[model samples]
Target: MTELQLTLEEKIGQMLICGFDGLTPNDHIQQLIEKHHIGGVIYFSRNYANVKQIADLSYELQQMNAASSQVPLFVSIDQEGGMVARIDNDEVTLVPGNMSIGASRDDELAYEAAVICAKELRQMGINVNFAPSLDINNNPKNPVIGVRSYGENADLVSELGIATIEGYQSSDLAATAKHFPGHGDTAVDSHYGLASVPHNQARLMKLELAPFIRAIQAGVDMIMTAHVMFPAFEPEQIPATLSRRVLHDLLRVQLAYEGIIITDCLEMHAISKEFGVAEGAVKAVEGGADIVLVSHTLQEQVAAIEALIGAVRSGRIQEEQIDVSVKRILALKHKRHVGEYEQLTGSVAEQFGTAERKDLIRQLTEKSITLVKDEQQLPLNLSEPTLVIWPEVRHHTQVDEPIVQAYTLGPALAELGANVKEFRIATHPTEEDIQSAIQLAAQYKQVVVVTYNAVSELHEGQVEIVRQIAARNDVALVVASTRNPYDLNQFSEVKTYLCCYENRPMTMSALAKVLTGQLKAQGKLPVTLSPEYSFGMAAQ
Candidate 1:
């Protein structure tokens, strides 16, 4: 151990990982490693340029730490495909979300997805995969967990979670089952601010905790604490990150999870709004969080170490506690054998994201298309100019876009026929836009309303518009439920509702094949919608 390692302050440094701003920030990160001895780094889109660049970066980062001390650093990232990937986007194959995979209901496919995810991550020197989102999306109004979750059902989620975990670890990457004690029922996002849950032990044990329990039973190597506050469980002042009741009493003791427990980012609004990163880091370790995440503070990374060191010396915190986390972390590193990347074996990228597994996404999209409520004209008159209502893919400037290819919906639609004219309906349809679609319906023999929800937002008016147009005598509705499938109430009139679950490359192709009569739609809805439709309802 280096001089820094001699102090509890320095070991705590190994607990607070951070994200940086380039593919080649390895040298600056190395300087920090030598200075503070941080536990690890959480990679985002910014730190990566391509596969080769990231692999080289990971090598240099590991080399610097080896030069300083033999204590291994946790190299981690969110490789949860669909929308959650953070490496070299263009260089990496963009996989669909968990719900899409769950829609297929194929365990092998889920396993393969993880295998590919792990292969790429492993090739680039990532040892910890902060993924296999075990959240049971029991709430339809849940904004963040909609597409990210496997489905609404607990058993389904547990099954897929196990498969995903297995896939990730198959290549020797440490799999972390996240947002512990269930982030499923909460309505708000922990990213923007704190979210609360008020359920008791009975309800939590029955529903919300199912996937988490199952995931833990499935051999999850790590568990990440949710930033959300569940006041009912422990009414005092602790969020899950700071709550010893949840982390120690429940997850550690009750669930019997002996591995490391990593807290979600301490820099998130939930943690930052109250405690500084240093204070949060100190409390989190006391709360039994083996690894406290400070993903955005490279400069302030040393502060947490300094605080913990002071606290340990003052008897406010103990050195043994720090050693506990350090031991668990070292075990994780040893399991990874951090310096032995070259010796790590099993599946590689070629085994992952194959043409066959890629085909499953298309197959699931076609199967998951839920035809909610449709008028008598089942297959449509087939002569109308189909109105394609696509919610604009809003561009967020805060996070860098992965170099992955720009996504589009044209080629799939074009396969059906050249005559299928497409119109861009604002996802949240406007009254005037409805009138425009209505007017176009008059000129065309059939009016097909194709709809898509961009993110968690419910394009409220579009469904009402579909309901109105579908009531027409000559018109037929073809509602394509793209993205999150929750907004099914928007199209009561459409004869066919398709839950494509996502807008990935294969999903579009599957939809195109189904619409053009190349393949019959076979997917059933994976989760329960409103009172309007039952769960697993798929069209013929």
Candidate 2:
């Protein structure tokens, strides 16, 4: 059990937390557990089917490792609730996201959200949740951490993030505060490429690093490093995930975070593009990460493990350092009692996605609906023919290709007894598509344009389409299903603007209720969208 007792290969294995390719363990992952002795496994959306399946999968993984290694695997997932949920089905109750909780400004609700997610994860045998993103969302152009973060205010992010951490830990689930020192100010998506934070250490301490500092104070179990460069910290343009000054000097020495240091996925282009996977893994450990996360490709995982082993053998990375990481990982595993996975007491089917949980989701969604602008255009006359212009934008993540789906708003609106005409277009509507929508808007008494994340420059077509339709139609309303409400800046003359904050089914249903006057808009803007319409602005 001592550092001197463990083999160099075992020590290297303890540093890696890898991802496999299937819902169940494949031959490759079995080899990884048996031979590599990897310390953990991180699950993705592809690894889950339902509650029972996830539980079974977690059990299988634990069993696979229990027979081989002394330490149990750290089964982790990105179950951050709203947009970043990996397990979404009828069996799992999806809570509102961080920003939604921040907008509600209810610390209890934030805690409740984390508790719900933690209970569900623990029930499924998942011990670690890479959640409660502590990044202060200071940049509107930030493509990745937009809705994942709580809000722009450091105090708000700190309060809600600490509440979440407390809730998760209360349920015996390890909560990881992520993308340190901060990923909020970057315009680039680190998943696709490297991002740089040009602010000096003073600015970072005040703005970007505030929430993380608070999270460390709140005793977050883990901190995930950002794949971003801080010029003032290192000045080498290397990511914080691979910078000793940022991780060892700042996080350990200055901030004094005692929890495990985990790197963001090494397969991400931010790391993989600049340094090969194996090299990045070595650098991350040398830089002071306790866990080097390799979230894809078995080849890369094996290579990284071999690289770490070689680094330790060559004295580039000392065995004492490896022992330090393994000891921390083992301590967490022992503290959490993460050994052989045990099935929950009751039927998982009945426990998960209960009617009460669904109702809670509905209530939370209702509270998060924000009416940013209104010219007395809401409570739409359901008796009249309404044109529902649905611009279907494909949701894109860093790892996955664009996922396309037709807009369901038209059908949902039609169910409300409105004579609805549905006009569907790609996210970027063609010039013809815009003209056609405009012409069709003339036929209806009212036109409702539905936009998904249209605030970004990438979705300018949707913005243009709204502008043209609003110019011709006197009763044009824009419902922005986005995290940021800055899209309203483009529609200065538009009569109505509604911010749903997210495009989930619960949020969309809440929007319908708000439009029908069944639910009042109670949520204030979490982040300032413009000078005229500041944070805490909402129609009462």
lDDT of candidate 2 over 1-540, digit per residue (tens) = 555567888877877888887878899789889999888898988788878877888898888787977678889998887767787666788888888887788888778777888888998999999997888887888888888888899889999899999999998899999889999999999988999999988989998899899888888899999999999999897999999999999999999999899999999999999999999999999999999999989999999999988888899998888888888888888777777468666777688877887887777778888888888888878887888887665555662224343335666676666677888876666788777877887777687888766767767878887887777745646555555656787777887787766666677777777777777888888888888778888865
CA displacement after TM-score superposition, residue 146 of candidate 2 (Å) = 0.7
After TM-score superposition, the amount by which residue 35's alpha carbon in candidate 1 deviates from its true location, in angstroms, is 1.2
Clashing pairs in 2: none
Per model, state how many residue pairs clash. Answer: 14, 0
**Candidate 2 TM-score to native:** 0.95
- Model 2 clash number: 0
lDDT of every predicted structure (CA atoms): 0.71, 0.83
Best by TM-score: 2
lDDT of 1 by residue, 148-218 (tens): 78888888888989999988887889999988888878887776677888888888888778888887787
State residue 81's C-alpha deviation in candidate 2, in Å: 1.5
Give the 10-residue window scoring lowest on summed lDDT in candidate 1: 397-406
